[model samples]
Target chain A: MINDNSEIILSVRDLRATVDGTEILKGLNLEVRAGEIHAIMGLNGSGKSTFSKVLAGHPDYEVTAGEIHFKGQDVLELDPHDRATAGIFLAFQYPLEIPGVSNRDFLRVAFNAHRKARGEDEIDVFDFDDLIEEKLDVVKMDASFLDRSVNEGFSGGEKKRNEILQMALLEPALSILDETDSGLDIDALKTVAGGVNQLANADNAVVLITHYQRLLDYIVPDFVHVMADGRIITTGGKDLAKQLESRGYEWVLEEFRAGVTA
Target chain B: MATVSDVSVLRTADQRDAYLKGLVQIAQAAVPENLALEEVRSRAASFLNEQTFPSTRQEDWRFTDLSAMLAIDFATTGEASVTEADIAELRLPETAGAQVVVVNGRVSRELSQLGSLPEGAVVGSLGDRPELQSQLADRLAQASGNHEVFTALNTVGFTDAVVVWLPRNQVVETPIQIIYVSQAQGDSLLVQPRCLVVAESGSALTLVEDYWGNSTATHFTNAVTELWLDANAQITHSRIEREGTGTFHIGKTVVTQARDSQYIGVAAGFGAKLARHNWEIYQTGEQTTTRIYGLGAISATQHADTHSLVALSHPHGIVEQEHKAIVDGKAHSVFNGRMAVAQKAQLTNASQLNRNLLLSDQARIDTKPQLEIVADNVKCAHGATVSQLQSDEIFYLQSRGISAPQAQRLLIYAFAMEILDRIPVETLRSRLAEAITQWP
Candidate 1:
C-alpha cells in the first residue's frame, strides 16, 4: 500500500550485516518513503536495534551484503558523519556522557558541520545562542542545560530530551529513533512524541524502533512491521500494533511459519 | 680497575669537563660584592663539582634520559643582547601588570616596566636592590638544595635574579608578570634564569612566569624559582613554558609555606624538544594549604617530564595535586607525583592523581602517583591512569555530523580543558585553549 508519487527517502534490499563475525541483520528488506512514519517492533535479540545501527554505518557492524539508497544516492559507501550531513539522523538509546564539552559548544559544532556541508554561512556564538534558545523550547528544556557538559550527570529523562533537542536542531530528512522511549516515563514520552510529530512533515520521514507498542499509541505510524530473526516477517497497519500489544508476538510468529510452510 | 666501557668513559669525561668549564667561567665573571651571595655561589659550585649529570641509571631519571642534553657542547657565555622589539611578540595579550623582562638570564631594565605597586612592595632585579640581600640570602637556596645537578647549576650560573617581594600586610592589586626569553646568539647557549619571591606575613600576591624562546636557535634554559610564604601569606603562581622546539629546558620550583599560609601553583608545558620540570613544596608550619596543578601537551617526537613532590612536615597540613598529559604522534610524556606526610604531621590530608591520554599508536606515557604517610591519623590517596581515546566516543560525536578530526579535536580539547579551566585568568585560559586546540 505504498504511495507511488511519494519520494523514496530510504530503500533497503536484502540487507545483511554482522558484528564480530556474528550475523545480526540477516536478509532484511525495508523501504521508507517521504510522508510516512514506520514502526519496527521486536522482542529482545530480534535485531531491531541492530537494524538502526547498521543504517547509521556503525563501526562495530559490518555490512556483508546490502544495498541502501537514500534520496537517489548510495548511502552504504558514506561515512557515519557524511551520512549525517546527507540528512540522516539516529537518536541513540543511550547518549554518551562527554565531560568538559559544554552542551552549547557541542550543539554548535554539530549544527555548523551540517551548515558547512550545505555551503551555508556558519552561525557565530551570539547567533547560535539565540538559535538554540528557540530549539530548547521544543523539549521544554531550561537554558541552564546548555552550560553543563553534554549529557554528563543528566537523568535518563533529561538525556532523552537532549536527544530530541539535537534532533530538532539538526532537522534531518530521515530520522531513526532506536528505543528512544524505553527509559522515559509517560510524561517524558508524551513530550518527546509531541516534538517528533511537530518536526515531521510531508518532505521527511521517521523510523521508530522499539520493543513496546506503547510509543505508537502517542504517534500513530503509517506502517507497522514485526521483525523476527533479523527479518520482517509481517507488515500491517496501526491495528497490528494494537493486536500485538493485546496479545503477544507468539501468534504472529506461528502464523508466519504456517504461511511459509503452506 | 673499574670495567667502564669506552662510550661510558667518554660520556663521563665529557660531563665532568662541562661541569668544570662552567664553574671556571662563572667564577671568572663579575661577582657581586656581597659576602652572603659569594658564599652561596661558592657552595653551589662545589656541589656541582661533586655531582654529575644523572642518566637513566638513577631512579628519578629512569623514564627520562638526559643523554641528548649532555651531548651538546653548551656555551658558557651568559650575555645575549635582546631589544624591546625582540620580546614584543612574546608578551601576553590583554594582561596588564608590572612587567619584568629577563633575556639570557640577565634582567633588562630597558624592557621592564615596574609599574607603581602597593606600599612596601618591591619588584626589580636583585642586583638593583642590594638592600634586600638578607631576604635573598635566607630563602634563595632554602627550597632547592645542592643535591640536584640542574638546581645547583642554576644556583651557580645565574647572572641576575628577578625578585618580587611584599612586606607585611601589603597586597598587590595586579599580578606581577616575569617573562624569560631565551635567544641564542650562537650554537648551544646556556641561560640560567633565577627568580626569588618572598611574601611576608599577612600579604598577598599573584605571580605569572612566562618562558619562551626563538624557534630558530638551539639553547639550554636552566631555570630555578624559590617561593617563601610567611605566616598567613597567600600566593597564586602560574608558570607557562613554551620554548623553542630544538631547545633543552630544565626548570625547578621550590615552595615553602609557613603556618596558616596558602600556595597555589598552575603550570602548563607545551613547547620544547626535551623539557623537564621539578616542583617541590614543603609545608613547614601547621595548618598550611598547598595545591599544584600541571598540564603537558607534547607531539611530534617531543618529550616532556614533570616531577612534583609535596611534603607535609607539620600537623594539620593539606595538599591536593593533579597532573595530566596529552601525548600524540611519537611524543612521550612522563608525570611523577609524590605526597609525603611526616610522623609529626597528624591529621594531614593529601590526594594526588595523574591522568594521561595517548592519541597515537606510537605515543607513550609514563605516570606514577606516590603517597607515603608516616602519621597514623593521616588520610592520603594517589591514583594514575593511562588510556587512549575511545572509538565509541568518536563515533558518537561523528553520528552528530561532526567530522572525525573535528570530533577528535573536541575530545582532546575537553580533556585538556579540565586543567585549563582551573586557571583564574580568562585571557590565559583562552590563549592556552587555542594552543591546545591547534596542537598536532
Candidate 2:
C-alpha cells in the first residue's frame, strides 16, 4: 500500500537505549512514513525488538540518548499510555495472560480509556459490543473468545490473532508488530497477516520485526532492513527479504563488520 | 442511658483482664424468665468465669493484638438510638420483606420486615413465637464450639437473637437477612448480636447476616451465629462485616451438618479497624458437601484475621475452601485454615488454598494452611500464596492506553473479584465490588 511521498509518521535519530543498565540499541536510525510497511530482520540480540520497546516508552527500556518524534511531537516526554493514545501501538512478542478479567471487559476498558483521552464520549457496553463483533471478523476469531479470560489458556496462534485484533480495533497510525508470526501456524499466520495488511492504509504505517521471511509473503513490505550491532546495516526493497531468506544473516554480519573495520 | 452507679462500676476496670470481668458482670444483670434459656445462660456464665481476654501468647490470638480494645471501658447495655431512616441504605432490595433489623443487639420490631413464613417456619426473636419455644429449648447454645471464649461471651450477654427454625421439608424461597447496625452512644459500647438457624430434614434456606455501620466513633461488637442442618438439607450462608471506623469486631460462625446435607459459606470483611472471624464447620453425616470462601479487603492501618476449620467425621464427604486478602498501606491480614479428617472419614476429598495480595511495602500478610489426616485412604491438599501485582501485567495494561493507577485498580479488582463474584446476592456482590473499587 505504498502511496505517494507521504507524511513522516515516526523518525528516530541516534536511538541509543539500554535495559537493566546494559546497552542494547546503539546509534539506531529509522524513518517510517505513512502508507509504508518496513520489515526489520536480524538475529537474536541484534536490538530490533529493543528499538520497538524504546519507541513505545517501556518503563524498563531506558532511552539515555535518543530522539523519537511521532507525527512531529516529542515522544520522550509522554507517558507510555500517552504514547499509545498518540497512535503508537506495539504488538507484544509474548502476550501476557491476565486471569479473572474477561476479554470483552478488557477491550472495553482499553477503548474507553482512549476515548476519554481524546475528550470524546465513551461507548457503552451495548454499542461497544456491536463494534467489537464487527472487528472480530478481521482476525477470524470466534465470539466465545470474548467471554473467556484475557489470553488465559489461549493457544499460541490464538494469542497472536488477539494481538492483531487489537490492532484492528485501535487503528493506530504506527503499529510495531514484534514477532507477530512467531507462534502462529500457516492458516493463523495468513489470517493475522491479512489483518495487518488490511489495517495498513495510506494514512498509517506498519513496522514488522521478524526473524523469518515467511510472513513477508502474506504482507508485502515496501522496504527490508537488516540490523546488526544495534544499527541498520542494509536497506533494500522486498527482494532483499528474498535474498536474506536464501543466504542467512551470517554473510550480512560479516559484511557489516568488514565495513566497520575498513 | 447509663445510671451514675453504672459509670462508677465501669471505672473499676484495672487491666484488660479486669475489663473482661466487668463486661461479664454487666451483661449478667438481665436474667431470662424461661427456665431453659436461663440454664443455657448459666452454663455459658460458668464457662466465661475462668476465661480472660486472649493475648498474643495464645496461638489463636498470635497475629491479632487485642490491646487496642482494652483502652475503652465499654458499656454492655445502651439505648439503641437508630431510626429506620438511618439504616435505609444498608437494607437490601432483594431481602425487602424478609429482613430483620437489630440495633445494638436488640431486635427492632418496628424496623423488621418479615414476610409470611410458610407452614412450620418461624422467623423472629427467641420469644417471638411461643409454640416453637419447647422445640428450641435444648437447641440453644449447644453447638460444638460453644465453649470458646468469645462465643461464651456472646451467650452470656446478648439480649435478643434472630432465630429461624424450619420443620422437615420446608423451603424458604427468599433470602432471610439479619441486619445488625451498631452505634456507640454516650460511651464506648459492647454490642453482642446473636443468631440461631435450624434447617430440618429436606429443607433449604439462604441466610445473610450483615453487620453494618458508618459511625466515626469506636464500638466493640462480638457476634455469634450457629446453624444446625438435618439430613438431606441445604443451606447457603453469607456473613458480611463492615463495621464503622475504629470499631473492634470479633465474629464466630459455627455449623453442624447432618448426613446428605450441603452447606456453603462466603465470609467477607472490609470496614473495621480490627476484625476477626472464626468459622467452624463439622460434618456429622456421610455424603455431605461443604464449601467455605473468605475475602478481606482492608487498608490504612486496619487489621483483619480469619480462622477457619472444617472437620470431617463421616465417609464420602467433600470440602473446598479458598481465602483471599488484599492488604494495602500498613494494614495487616492473617488467614489460618485447618482441615481435619478422622479415621471414619474414608474416601473424602478436601482441598484448601489461601491467596493474598500485598499492595504496599509496609503491608503485611501471614497465612497458614494446617491439615491433619488420620485416614490412610483419603485425599487432602492445602497451599498458601502471598504476592504483589506483577509488573509485566501492569505494563501490558499500560500499553493498551490505561493509566498506571487505573491499571492497578483493574488488577486489584480482578484479584478480589475471584472470591467476591461467588457471593449469592447480586446487589450485595455489586456493592462490595464497588467498595473494593473505591478502596485506597
Candidate 3:
C-alpha cells in the first residue's frame, strides 16, 4: 500500500501481464513519484516494451493478476486513450504511421482531447497554430514539417523528435519515453533530452524506457531500475547507471549469483 | 387504376416505339439548335438504329447486365420548375462565386446565380453558344468515337449543357458549382447533361458538378464533362455523384492539358445501382501535369465500375492516379486504371495505383492497374492491391474505447480520406467530411 503523503502518481503491485497465453510481465512491482525521473534499462526480450504497453492499456497484453493505481484510480479499467487522457503518456518505441492525418491536426486533436477530458475548452484553429509554432521550436522542427502526414515518411530522428513534440504539446503527468533514444544521433539525443528537461516539473514525472545506458548520460535519470526476466531486479541512485555503463549487465548478474550463493 | 390502360401496350414493340417518338419530340423542342447539333443527333440515331440493346456478351457489361435496366419503359421527363426553397436546399458550403443550377437536364435561369462573374467569364448552356459548338463537334469526332452506345446516345440526345469560358489571365475567386437534381416520376427517363470548361492562358478556375436525385423510384443518369486547358492555365474539377439506391448512372470526363498547364480531377461515387465513370486525361503539350483520384463506396446489390486512362503523348508530361473502392454486402466494384507513355514522351513520369477493401466474404472486386511505357527514358509504375481491413487496426481502435461500428467507420473514413483530402475546395471537403461523419 502507498502512504498517504508519498506523492506517488503510479503504483503497480505484483503486476503480471500476458499475451497469447504467454507470460510477459511476471509479478512486476514499481512506484513512480512526482518530480522524479526514472530510467528502466534491460536487454532485448526482457519485456521492457510489454511492461510499458501493459500500463498504457495495450489490448494485446492481458494482465492476469495485478493491481494498478493511477492517481488513486484503478488504471486496469481505463482504455488506451483514456489512460492517456488521465495523464499517462507512452511514447511508442515504434510509432504508428497514420497516413492522411496531418501531424499538426493529430497533435491538435490529441491536445484538445486531453484538455477536454480535464474540463478545458478546445483551442481554436488560430490559437492552435500559434501553440504548435511555439512547441515546434522545442524539437528544432521546421514549420513545414507540421503540414506533412503524421510520421508518414519521417526520418529516424524526425520521428523521435515528433514524439517529443507530442509529449510537449499534451503535457501528460507521467510521460513514459519508450526507447526515444533509439535511432537518434548524438545531436538528436541531446535535443530530445533538452526538450524533456524543459517539461520536467515538480507535479509531473517522466519514465525513460530504454535499453542503452548511453542515453542516461545525457538525460541523467534520478533513479535507475535494471529489469531482467520481466521484472525489476535492482534499483539504485544515478551512479548505478554509470556503473552499468562501464561494466555492462554482467556485473549485476555476478552480484545476483553471489547473493544467491550466500 | 392506370395499369389497366397500359397493359395491352406493354407487350408489343410499339410500346418502345411510342416512347422513343415522344423522347425525340422532347429533345427537338429543348435543343433544336443549328446544323452541328443536328448532325450529332443524326449520327446518334444511326448508331442506335444499327445496334441492339446492350447485353452480357460485352466485356464491360458482363457484370452489370443492362437488359433489365433498359426494360423500364418510361417517357422522357419534361421541363419542371423549381422554387427558391428547392435551390436553397441544394446549396453547397462554398458558393460565393458562380452557382448554376440545371434542373432535369436544362439550365434553370431562376435558380442560377452568375452575377459575380467577371466581364469576360462565360456561364451558359452549350445550346446558347452556337459558335463554340462546331469546335466541340470537331473534337468529339476525332476523340474516342462513341464506342459505348450509352455515350453515343447521350452525345446525340444532349439538350442542355453548362459552358464556362475564362479569358486570358482572368482568375475566378469562387468555384463554379453546377447543381444537377433530377425529379423523375415513376416512368423511366434518360437525361444527358454535358459541361464544357475552357481556360485561357494563365487563368485559374475551379469547377464542381454535384448530382442529386430526390425521387425514391428508379432513375437513370448519364453525364459527361469536357475540359480544355490552354497554355499555363490551371483547372480543378470535382465530381460528386450521389444518386439514390435505384439510380443507374454512367458519367465520363475527358480533359486535354496544354503546355505548362495543370489539371486535377476527382470523382466520388456514393450511391447508385450501377455507376461507371471514365476519366481520360490527354497531355498534348510539354511540361503539363495531371492528377486523378477516384473513390467508390458501394453497398447492397450495387455495381460500380470506374475506368481511367492517362495518355502522355508529349515530352515532359507527368500523370499520377490513386483509385480505391470499398465494397460491402453482395456488391461488386471494379477499377481499371491505365497509363500509356508514347515513344516521343521522353521525360514523362506516369504512375497508377488501385487499392480495394472488401468488407464481406461474398463481396467482390476486380482492380486492374496497367501501365504501358513505350518511351525508354520515362519512369512509369502501376500497382494494385485487394485486401481487407487489418484486424490489428480494429483491435487498436477498440482498445481506445471505440466500439466495433465506430471503429469500422473510422477505418472506412480513413480509407476514403486518402482520396478525399486531394480535393482543393475547403467547403466541399467539409461537406464530404460531414457526409462521412454519419456513416450508415
Candidate number with greatest DockQ: 1
| Leading candidate by TM-score | 2
DockQ values, each candidate = 0.84, 0.78, 0.20
Query: Per DockQ, what order, best first?
Result: 1, 2, 3
- Per-residue CA lDDT of model 1 for B1-440, tens digit only, reads 55569777777768766765664465336344542387777787787767766778788999998777655667756457788788776555434548899988878888888765766788889878777877677788767444688887777667788998899989886878899999866778777889999999989988889898757577888899999999999999889999999888999999989999999899999988889999999888999999889999999999999999888889999898889999999999998888888999999988888889998999999888777888999888888889888888888899999988889999999999988887766677888899888886
User: In model 2, how large is the Cα lDDT of residue A47?
Assistant: 92
The residue-by-residue lDDT of candidate 1 on A97-118, one tens digit each, is: 9998999999999999999999
Off by over 4 Å in 1: A1-4, B1-36, B144-146
Is model 3 an incorrect, acceptable, medium or high docking prediction?
A: incorrect
- Which window of ten consecutive residues has the lowest lDDT sum in model 1 chain B? B27-36
lDDT of 1: 0.87
- List residue ranges in candidate 2 displaced over 4 A: B1-16, B30-36
Q: Rate the local accuracy (lDDT) of all candidates.
A: 0.87, 0.88, 0.78
Across all candidates, what is each one's fraction of true contacts kept? 0.78, 0.65, 0.16
Worst 10 residues of 2 chain A by lDDT: A1-10
Please, what are the lDDT tens digits per residue for candidate 2 over residues B1-440?
99998785455434656878877877766434542366778899898878877878689899999977777778766677799888888788888788899988878889999874576688888746546656776677888999888999888878788888888999998888889999856668888888989999999998888999888677889999999999999999889999887789999999999999999999999988999999999898999999989999999999999999899999999999999999999999999898899999999999898999999999999998989999988888888999999988888888889888989999999888888888898898899889888886
